[model samples]
Target: MSEVLPQFRLLQPGTAEEAIAAKLASPSARVCAGGTDLMVAMRRGLVETDTLIDLAGIEEMTAIEVNADGLHIGAGVNLRRIAGSSLIAKDCPAVAQAALTVAGPTHREVATVGGNLCLDTRCLYYNQSDSWRKANDFCLKYRGDTCHVAPTGNRCRAAYSGDLAPALMVHRAEIEIAGPDGRRRVALQDFYREDGADHLALDPTEIVTGVHVPPSDIASAYAKLRIRSAIDFPLAGVAVACEITAASAHRFSIAVTGTNSRPVLFEAPDPLTGDDDPDVFFAGLNKLVQKSVSPQRTTTTAAHHRRLSVAALASRLARKLSAA
Candidate 1:
């Protein structure tokens, strides 16, 4: 643990209802599932909560079950369990692969699926110790008025670098949120905002309770680019899901992440169909991805490198899908 953690009260709730009640009572409370991301933000002084509502004790939020409709994953379900779950592996290999790419083995064991989906957007200027940020004026993501990434912009330009989000977006997953207003279901694709400072559409009083992934017959794959194979966020990545019938491809959905404030879903130039040559498909995909993804200067990696990585990953995923 870092030495810069702020003082706060911890509340362990046995059920999601209790947790929501506690959060409503505190108003400024933050929810903690695995504390994988929350703890890091606290240590960096990016998050200062007066109370933390721990949801780990809620058994219902940790169950993984397959139902007649599809798979139901509790928000508290950890990444290691998702990666190892036979149900998820058989039904949604893209999601399983994305889960496997999060951090490393140790982090996967502690990071929950909900936590990953609700990950805080990252920026070079925002995620730092108080002393480090104080040396220079803070960014818009924090208390400062100016955004270091885009000084002319009024909103924060932090990047959403989570690997699982793009994969889940391809699946058309739905998020279940519980709060004082009652429960509501939101399409995962519509759950995120483009602004990094307020990334999730979730209200402050709400906490994600579970995720629902509908069953599908589509073939899918996830490819990520990072500085290292372990413990590093993706510099650029792509997730693809599509269906092929009678030697023609249909229902194509391609999502690109780690390059912008929100994951960008690429629209095919035209309906992609037929057993097209891998080279042809790759060329088309490369062009579309390169045009769609515009990497910012937030990370240490060069923007051009990130753009190239996205194109390369998309090409690889297209080849893999064609081969399948």
Candidate 2:
């Protein structure tokens, strides 16, 4: 059965300040960037809102710029632009590659960076038709009391399946937020919490204005495991950023998504270089990633499969970057 959207007033804000004020003024208001994810959840009766604060018209949040500080990408910037941006690709290939993996090209055309960064967590038990959910007594992420994925746990087990957050986190990106008081910035990794029912660290009236990434000499790449080549969220994803370090030192970074409530970062192991045996190195890498990810039965795939795939992806990415 086709679901219907709740009645809501759309408030178009021309600036970040206006958007923050609009959200603060309406008690039942929710912010909308690209509306790619929010609208779908709203239609499914997962989100109840009377007003939507649209940030499409805000110029400051829709532009990309490069200065001495580094690359500044507005939150409203679409995934399509980010995927195809030469500057972004050259500066941080992981970000562009991650953006390209989001859904499909058409969805990317309209999906904004902010939307991806703040994507709602997903769980098979949580995402369902109203009738289907009612029959199951709903879920912990919504109206129900128990999380079907982890009934014994108090918090939700919905997975954060976004691909971009991990890639950005590897670059040490910072998030710019506009609120009722003023604008503030925080590290991108700090923007998310482990609780899936309430993932983003943003307040009700706060808006993610943009992201700032400093330039680095490291080379990086991104890859994800999905059921389909297009239009599907990742089952597990990996982003690897590595630099050519001194012969005695092995230094790099790895970030993962789709297996937990929030994107996770891991420090690369020392001595994980050409000197080590390929089989031995990969075995250690696999063990580390598998342990790092806590995959639940949140999707159709088995949790073990997702965990294995994450380890494989991490090993593959590290090998590719090291060779490059």
What residue pairs are clashing in model 1?
Answer: none
How do the residues 17-52 of candidate 1 rate in per-residue lDDT, one tens digit apiece? 899889778888999988988998898888888899
* TM agreement with the true structure for every prediction: 0.95, 0.97
Stretches of candidate 1 above 4 Å error?
Answer: 245-247, 269-271, 275-277
| lDDT per residue (tens digit) for residues 235-267 in model 2 | 888998887776734566889998899999887
Q: Cα lDDT of model 2 overall? A: 0.89
TM-score of 1: 0.95
Candidate 2's C-alpha runs over 4 A off are 271-274
RMSD of each candidate? Answer: 1.8, 1.4
Q: Which lDDT values do the candidates have, in the order given?
A: 0.83, 0.89
